[model samples]
Target: MPDPSQKRPVIALTGATGYIGRNVMESLIDDYDIIALSRNGDAKDNEEHVEWRSCDFFSFQDALKGLRGADYAVYLIHSMLPSAKLTQGTFEDMDVILAQHFARAAAENGIKQIVYLSGIIPPHEHRDELSRHLQSRLEVETILGSHGVPVTTLRAGLIVGPDGSSFPILAKLVRRLPAMILPSWTRTKTHTIALPDVIHAFQQVVGREDVYSRAIDIGGPDVMSYQELLQRTADIMGKKRRFIPFPFPTVKLSRLWVTLVTQEPKEMSYPLIESLAHPMVAEARQTVPGISDGKITYEEAAAAALDEEQKKQEEKKREQEEEGSKTPSPVRKLKQAVKSDVRSVQRITLPEGQDAIWAGDEYLHWLSRLASPLLHIKTTRTGVQQVYVLWWKKPLLELTFDVGMSQSDHAIYRITGGRLLHAKRAHNGRLTFLQIPNSRECIVAIHDYMPSLPWVMYKYTQAKIHLWVMKAFGKYLRRWKHRSTTDTKAAPRQAMSQHDSTVR
Candidate 1:
């Protein structure tokens, strides 16, 4: 055992239980003390240098506490899976909210550097043309660096691991199907990286200052087509399979079949399948030095992944047998509950020189105007904002400003008590207006909100209306931004014309 008196740098790592995060933490366990952030806020038994902290990325306070004593941080979060039972936003929007909070918290806590795992972004003049999954990754990379923290971004293509989402899906498909129907996308060239190599790359760059704020592409020695990857996996498994080439690329149909065959959630598979058309090979200019040596080949990676997966299956079987007589844990029961909380997020362009406080104030007033005939909004002397529908006895929704947590660039409003909210269970529910520091983008988000109505009723009525209203408000903000710019430009011309008249 290492000396307890010796000091080691504490690295605060998000997604600590995820596949890549678990591997990365294990790789660096000997050299660094790690603050592992989990939603459940629990640590494993007998972890020598690891401290577990419960962190909800949706809450800035939680993120701030999680990174409090860390010298550096690692961000490996992806929002493809739903956080709550009822999530009413796109995965991209959800990812943005989480990134904004984490970035701000990291900056506030004086973290020196952040190492982020991201997906490779193909060369595109218009970022809108990129797949949704890759686009979110790129956005996250930008946000992590926006808070004045040096972020080392390692972008990888398909990571071949023992039991992750992407590689396991591929392996399952190969093993289950006797004959594979190959689409045109199967010919797209992409790179692959072994899990061990990825962990090695992280170990090299996490504390290094030279590669700070740089995006590095990590991959295996071989850049092969997707069809070749499938074939290599088949060869490793010693399975005879026939591939029939279909000339057309229909990603929508392909994603469905892939999900069905692999038994993976569509949330995970769809974005990946959508990205198969893009060539994801790494750029030579973005490669890291010295770390490229001794990279594993695809064949070697496939064999090792298969062996490891088999071992994991055996272990899982033994554990299941042991736990057969035991009851489910409370956390498991909570996850299985039908009525879950709600999270909604939307990004809006902030007008020039406006802050989050202005946005939050504008939203309250604007909402009243938008629903003028139906709803009435009022604010009390205590700064509690309430929304009432047609002078009903009770307010539909009530928002109390959290002054202690609110800042110039960030505003927090707790969903205190309301007729439309499940007040008893809405302990953490809040509405936040977040202005990204040094940028014109802002996020309006609702987190952990539970509705008073039944789940199905709320899903159809309140959820749909909320989304529609947010979209309209987003458009309204953009129009305000455009009008603000126009008015500013017109003011200069108006002054010049008056000066010319006076001179004449």
Candidate 2:
């Protein structure tokens, strides 16, 4: 037990970069002196009161260095990476070995408590290969308990959050698809907890003195079927989805299907699909004191996940814009003085005769080509040219570009409204539509890729790449306009609709 008179306890955290681990880190930021451990070294050089250490979890000696001088150590590491060489047949064996290693290390370091976030398994359930993941989790719980260092294990089901492996994929699939072919397991009941709620549970365990060496099940207010979850998510997304549950056995096929749809690695999806095959609803009526009462409802948890996903998409779009603006185009450089002057000088002109007929045509053409691979571009005939200009209040350069190969096949592009536009792509490849304000001159900026190669080695190579294509197209169009000698009029522009900008 931590002495009340002592200063904040030094707590070591494993899996600091993981989804659940990140939430725990944020919750403990001001409360404990965190010693964060990850295979990748400390992300930043300086974290106030947080000591960042790098460790290879597979190596006992390496992991021990991070556990030193820690009162409580959170062991959140799991072997979910698809590329790991461990056989699926021996997952439980590997988990036992790892847990023993961690337990020994914590005991040697004189750590007071071993806090672990584990999966919940209902008592009396049939234990099979599908339930192996939970069994392994339970094995770790026992291993930690044997070490004499009290362990507090918080068992939870699917963690609902933007970054969570299962929920984000589920939410995106529900939002994007109008119909789904669900497995037989869709009828199986499961429990869920919001990422925030899971973090709160950990905080409670960390702060409580009487809570050691216990395995507690934590869940949100509802225990619903997989089909019900899908329906609720669909309702929130404002989409009607048809879920057809075939009588076919789905362990193998469903795993493959999830892998394709979510683009999550096979290793991660396999265990999850197997777990879902069994009903994962909580059986125990007892709850952790103080922590369980504050649990959120399924609807609220779903809403939080959706909100976080939307925010993540917006942030990714901003990052892409910033990256795009930094790499200057050769043509942009030539017109830099004029371009800078144009921002301070705004004017609208209308073309005469047939020339005016194609005023919106060129902007639409540029927009279509620019967002082509990324968005299903379209235009409206209402003589409206909606432009959105976002200037950085700071000195940072902004740029955006599609990171995937093949424009038409890219996940970032999608259709919205009657016009062609560049929709935002979250860092995780979730697509979102941008609401643009109406303006005569809207700068649709994109980031160009800057290679890490030597400047001389790749400067011209970079110039000849995608940017060259855009530059050449722009130049040819300008020449065509000059030769035609037609006067074109700018169309009326409108600001972004308030309704469009707000998420319901």
Candidate 3:
């Protein structure tokens, strides 16, 4: 059954599910056999081309599991936008640990080449003043190279594409804001690259010994200011925006503003905001003829990216329509599949009515606080989806989401960063109170979502903990009802005593 002729060189691609990684695999799958790594460990029968590997890079052993039998291990993984719960230290620390493990694994597994994508840093004169994100990227690059692995680093700035961290935020910021309340960071200049260009750069360097253990800066032909990037993006989207550069430094304030306007979490926007303050450009780009010839202008890339995004939206709409047509009913509903595979749903019927159990906003806030002391639950409104940001005090990881509801029914529960890709560790849950038309009693449904990992972790550790929480939640509802009943009884007794005292 084995075909030796068709067997290609295996490329273990970590962060394969990421925006850049997905594009890279799509482009390179024909040339190389690919091992796609996902943090969630998700695999389905219908997934095509690449071989899917489920192990996340959180553990050295677990991360190393996917790299076996591969000729080249692409380090697309990074911790830019960290997920729900980060126990201690910054993302910088975690990234260094991941690189050390990856380097060790590659050395042991006989993987010859290790290609990494990193953030663009300032030129040597200003390198020390690079932002936290850029600094973290440099640290990761340093760690990845220390094991004597032939690591080729492709340092890119302001990747402009669909589903990428940079351009989407810009497109959104322009569309959302009539006037961008810009700051000093807006004037910082940086080189930009198209998605296709970056992938081409990745493909060009395979098995090339000359470029080994060296850093190559990659970007589009055009270099522009951060403010110009914003304006041009706005122009591409057919919108005009007014800009006001504030007097103060924008590193911190810009983060807060982006989040407030776009509903993007600080985990993403903060690093980006910090990086925007620096003038990030390539120190050395390809001077050779063929490599430099293919570069696109920043405006062209933005326009093309916008067009691609629109087409994708149209395609998604068509698919949703087709799916809806196949399953037709009087009360029809469309829903998005939960992003995670680890799911738990529990239902309970309460004796009290939906109104009695369904408390107001104040009560909801109180319940959320009491349910988890670690959880700091807050909400933001996006034009499209309802956003909820949950920060677990125990772990610094914050789960920020844009929760969407189905058209007909709410079977709901749901909800990436760029390359230097990310791992999402989400534990999203909600309680819904329901009242049937005829029935007096109310129904409560508990739905939670998380990533599916090892059998022991999913079945024993995570599932059990979730079940216990659900049980405690039901108990809280029962206690609330009892307290309400007791208060009602005491009110009449107190009223009678007051009347008697007044009569006397």
Which candidate wins on lDDT? 1
Q: For model 3, state the Cα shift of residue 479 in Å.
A: 51
Identify the superior model by TM-score, candidate 1 or candidate 2.
1
- Cα lDDT tens digits, model 1, 1-504, are 234577888899888888888898899898899999988766454378888888989898898888999999999888887778887767987888788888989999999999998877786536888889888888888888888999999888888888777788899999999998899999999898888988899888977889999998888888988899889888889999999999999889999999898867678899989988888888888887755332898888878988999997798778878988545543465467534788888888887877786777778878998999799787775667889999697999999877667767887889998898887773689999887656888888899888889989989999999989988988988888433333322332333455557768
RMSD of 3: 20.0
Per-model TM-score on C-alpha atoms: 0.89, 0.61, 0.62
Full-model lDDT, candidate 3: 0.62
**C-alpha lDDT of residue 256 in model 1:** 97
Worst ten-residue run, lDDT, model 2?
Answer: 339-348
User: Which residue runs does candidate 3 get wrong by more than 4 Å?
Assistant: 1-7, 46-49, 84-88, 125-128, 285-294, 317-504
Q: Please write out the lDDT profile of model 3 over residues 197-288, one tens digit for every residue.
A: 88888888766788888788887788888888888888777887999887777477778878787766566678777778787787654323
Which pairs of residues clash in candidate 1, taking residues 3 or more apart in a chain or in different chains?
none
For model 2, the superposed segments whose C-alpha errors exceed 4 Å read 1-5, 82-93, 325-504
How far is 92's C-alpha from truth in model 3 (Å)? 1.2
- The whole-model lDDT of each prediction reads 0.83, 0.59, 0.62
Ranking by TM-score: 1, 3, 2
